[model samples]
Target chain A: EADIYQTPRYLVIGTGKKITLECSQTMGHDKMYWYQQDPGMELHLIHYSYGVNSTEKGDLSSESTVSRIRTEHFPLTLESARPSHTSQYLCASSDSWMLSVPQYFGPGTRLLVL
Target chain B: AQKVTQAQTEISVVEKEDVTLDCVYETRDTTYYLFWYKQPPSGELVFLIRRNSFDEQNEISGRYSWNFQKSTSSFNFTITASQVVDSAVYFCALSGTGNQFYFGTGTSLTVIP
Candidate 1:
């Protein structure tokens, strides 16, 4: 099945710990995005990648960074975690050349920093 | 600048009743796209419908229908004969350059059986 996947659906970590949220898609999409959302709140874009070796920050400023080493993989890493970083991280991918296609989303990873 | 707005914060309707979720958007690009997504308790977004700037045609799928009005800058979704499964957070989004999507705050819906 071609779908987006995120690892460690739920995570709990202490503040100052280093963490990486993994995201992969089997759909072979070229554009991938990472979004942060609080429980029952709106989603905010944090990072995105156009393709391999291309990454960019999103509208909302985030302490985490992302890398796109492959077309199907985009991972986000936080050097030092904080309580403020506790939120659900969602991964999405869309076709590169399609203008009207909707993005395909993966089940979010819920992180808790104590 | 691209922005999407869902004026209704929350709504509750009894089963079998009809419900409508409103979506308004703003953008400078002449060519753009609009989308609606459903987020269930599982927290994954499911795409419902997509429309373009030039297409004003209304669409219906099963018990769901969408109204796209470029004149009012609105693209609304209506679910007829609501069911418990229809309860979820509905979001409206706008893609101005097709590279970025601007999402609304989302409207949470509850259906009472």
Candidate 2:
């Protein structure tokens, strides 16, 4: 089945530690996005990629960065984690289309920084 | 700026009761896309419905229905004879001239048996 996947569903790390959240999709989508969401809160876009070797920051400023070295993978890395980074990170992908496009989401990774 | 607003934060209803979740959006673009997604306790979002700005026709799938009104910039979802399994957070989103989806603050629904 075509689906999106995320690794390290749950993580606990000390502040200032380096971490990378992995996201992959088998749907052959060209556009991928990363969003930050708190428990019982709204989703805020942090980063996105158009395709291989194409990445851009999202509406909400984030300390983390993302890379799209391959079309099937988009990983997000934080240089130094902080308590404010404690939240669920969601990955999504959408096929190329101008109108009426629907994005599919993956199981989120919940990170806790202490 | 594109924005989506889901007014009801949380709603609780009996298993057999009918419930409606309201969604309002704001966008300057003449054409846009709207979507509804359901997120269970497991925390993965599942797509429910998608409608374009030109298609004002209402959609019905199983016991779920969506009302999209371009004049009022509203897209509402209704679940008929709600079930315990229907308990989850529902979000409404808007896509304007790009790949990004402006999501609303989700509406948490609890269906009690």
Candidate 3:
């Protein structure tokens, strides 16, 4: 089993509320990523980090922001949650510093903004 | 631009039957990588297999196998004697230039027992 964990497996919040989705990995991986996926749809890369203090935007633009202050923790925060942000958020980690490495994923957090 | 396409949106197979998932990709980079991931109803992705661009050899593990063909730009997955537990959404991905990964629109497989 993968050591990666996402807190609050399910969340239901009202619009304009502040929400933070936490992701932590105990595997000591150097690369981490955040993806947004809808039911029966493809996963869209929203954010990723090469390492601590390194963050980059992904192919799909997102309103949420991610921070990589610690190696094991990568947190995503939405300042003002909206109905559009209601989707499943997936967190993943890769051991390899290079791309194309197989990634281990955590049980995604399903968010619903009312 | 790198893209992965899974033409079949859903596939149904009875227990002990075999099913193949089609994946076609487009990439200009010669040193790209193709991947297959399985996502059950639980909503977590499980890495099934990864194939580098230089390797065109077919790979098989247990009852699962992958066929990679550079000529057709396709990486297909086949499962033999599939069980009810094999029911899930399968996604094909491509990691091309800059290590960016692109995912397919997943194929939902239902194996009725």
Candidate 4:
């Protein structure tokens, strides 16, 4: 199994609340990504980080922000969450050998904003 | 920009039957990567296969096989004599030099016993 993990497997919160989804990997991977996906739908890249302190927004412009303070930790924060932010968030990590290396994904965090 | 398209939204096949999933991609990069991932009921994405653009050779692993055709810009997956355990949502993805990965909407396959 992959050594990646996501906190708060399920969350239900009222609107306008700040929330953060946690992602941690023990594989020491340099690349980490945050993807937003609706149930049974495609995954949209929301944020990605190449390494520690390196972060970039993905193709799908998202209201959330991500930080890579430690190599094993990449957390995404959403200030004043709204119903539009209700979706499953998947976390994945990969090593430098990306050509042949497949990304390992976490269990994913399911969020429901009221 | 790299994009992957899984035209089939859902497919149903009886157990012990064969099923094929189609994946079409668009990219200008000479070298890139294609991948297939399975998301089961557990909601965990499992890496199924990865094929680089340079490698056009088709691959077969047990009941799962991948056909990569550069001429048509298509990479199709075939599952022969599939079982109920094969039911899941399969996604086709593309990644280029920048470590940016893009995924398709995915095809949901159901294997009925």
Candidate 5:
């Protein structure tokens, strides 16, 4: 089954702790994105990658950073977590072309900074 | 700037009833794409349907149907004979030529037994 996966489905950490959210897709998609969302709120894009060694910050300014070392992996890291960073982080990937090319999302990792 | 608007914050319907979710979009580009996704309580986003700017052809998948109207920049989804399993949050999204997407706040639907 080709699908996107995120690790640590739920996380609670101290405010100053450093954490990394893992995302991997076996679908071999070239475009991958990271979005932050609160419960029942609109998704806000935080980072994206076109391919390996290519990454870009999204419209919403975020303190976290992402890396695309491999096509199947795009991980986001926060050097110092804060309470404001508590939210659900979703990972998505899609092919470049198609009639719609709707993104396929992962199950998401819910983070709580205490 | 591309934007998507879903005016209905929440809706409730009885099982076997029909319901419609409205989506409106704004974009400067002539060509763009629209999409609908369902998020259940488990928090997984499921892709439902997609429509492009040039094609206004309505589509039906089982009891689910979509209406796309380019004139009004609207894309609406309707579920006929709804069931309890249809309860979820539906989101409408738009993406321009740049490949960046904008999404609506979403509409929450609840189906009563």
Candidate 6:
């Protein structure tokens, strides 16, 4: 089993609220990513980080921001959340040295903005 | 450009029946990677298999099998005697540019008993 974990598997908040989604992995991976997905839809990459203090936006634009201060922790924060931001957020990590390996995914956090 | 396509949006099959999921991909790189992942209702993506461009040999694990055809640009998955436990959305992905991954929309499979 993968050691990746995401906190608050489900979340519901009012619009304009600032929230943070936590992601941690014990595999000591150097690459971490965040993806947004709707029910039964494809996953859209929103953010990723190569290592500590390195972050990049993904193919899909997102209002959320991510910070990688530690190898095990990559947290995403949404300022002034809106109902449009409501979706499932998935966290994944992979070994930097192995490009052919599959990414380990977390259980994912389903966010509902009221 | 790298892209993965899963043409079937959904499929329903009776228990003990066989099912196949189609996946077609496009990439500019000669050496790329193909992958399959299963996402249950729980929402976690479980890695299934990974195949490289150089190896076109088909693979089989238990009742699950994969067919890779470079000429057709297809990597199809087949499950024999599928069970209800196999019901889930399966996604096909392609990775050619380093760690960048391109994923298909996914094909939802429902195995009814």
Interface RMSD of each: 1.2, 1.2, 1.2, 1.5, 1.8, 1.2
lDDT tens per residue, model 1, B2-105 = 88999999999999999999999999999999999999999899998899999999999999999999999999999999999999999999887846889999
Candidate 3 stretches greater than 4 Å from native: none
Per-residue lDDT of model 1, residues A1-114, tens digit only: 239999889999999999999999998899999999997788899999889999999989999999999999999999999999999999999986566878889999999999
lDDT of 3 by residue, A21-112 (tens): 99999999988999999988999999999999999998899999999999999999999999999999999998885556888899999999
Candidates 5 and 6, the one with greater TM-score: 6
> Each candidate: RMSD to true structure?
1.1, 1.0, 1.0, 1.2, 1.3, 0.7
lDDT by residue (tens digit), candidate 4, A1-114 = 689999989999999999999999999999999999998789988898999999999878999999999999999999999999999999999998556678899999999999
Off by over 4 Å in 1: none
Q: Stretches of candidate 6 above 4 Å error?
A: none
State the local distance difference test value for candidate 4. 0.93
Pairs of residues clashing in candidate 4: none
Q: Write model 2 residue lDDT over B9-103, tens digit each, in one string.
A: 99999999999999999999988999999999999999989999999999999999999998899999999999999999999999887757999
TM-score for each of the candidates: 0.97, 0.97, 0.97, 0.96, 0.97, 0.99
Would you list the rank order by DockQ, best first? 2, 3, 6, 1, 4, 5
Better of 2 and 5 by lDDT: 2
Stretches of candidate 4 exceeding 4 Å from the true structure: none
Highest DockQ: give the candidate number: 2
In terms of lDDT, the best-performing candidate is: 6
Instruction: For candidate 5, write residues B1-113 as lDDT tens digits.
Output: 78899999999999999999999998888888899999998787899888889999999999999999988989999999999999999999997867877889999999999
lDDT of each: 0.93, 0.94, 0.94, 0.93, 0.93, 0.94
DockQ comparisons of all candidates to the true complex = 0.75, 0.78, 0.78, 0.70, 0.68, 0.77
What's the true lDDT of residue A92 in model 6? 97
Chain B TM-score for each model? 0.98, 0.98, 0.99, 0.98, 0.98, 0.98
Q: Write the per-residue lDDT of candidate 4 for residues B1-113, one digit (tens) a residue.
A: 68899999999999999999999999999989999999998787999999999999999999999999999999999999999999999999988867677789999999999
lDDT of 6: 0.94
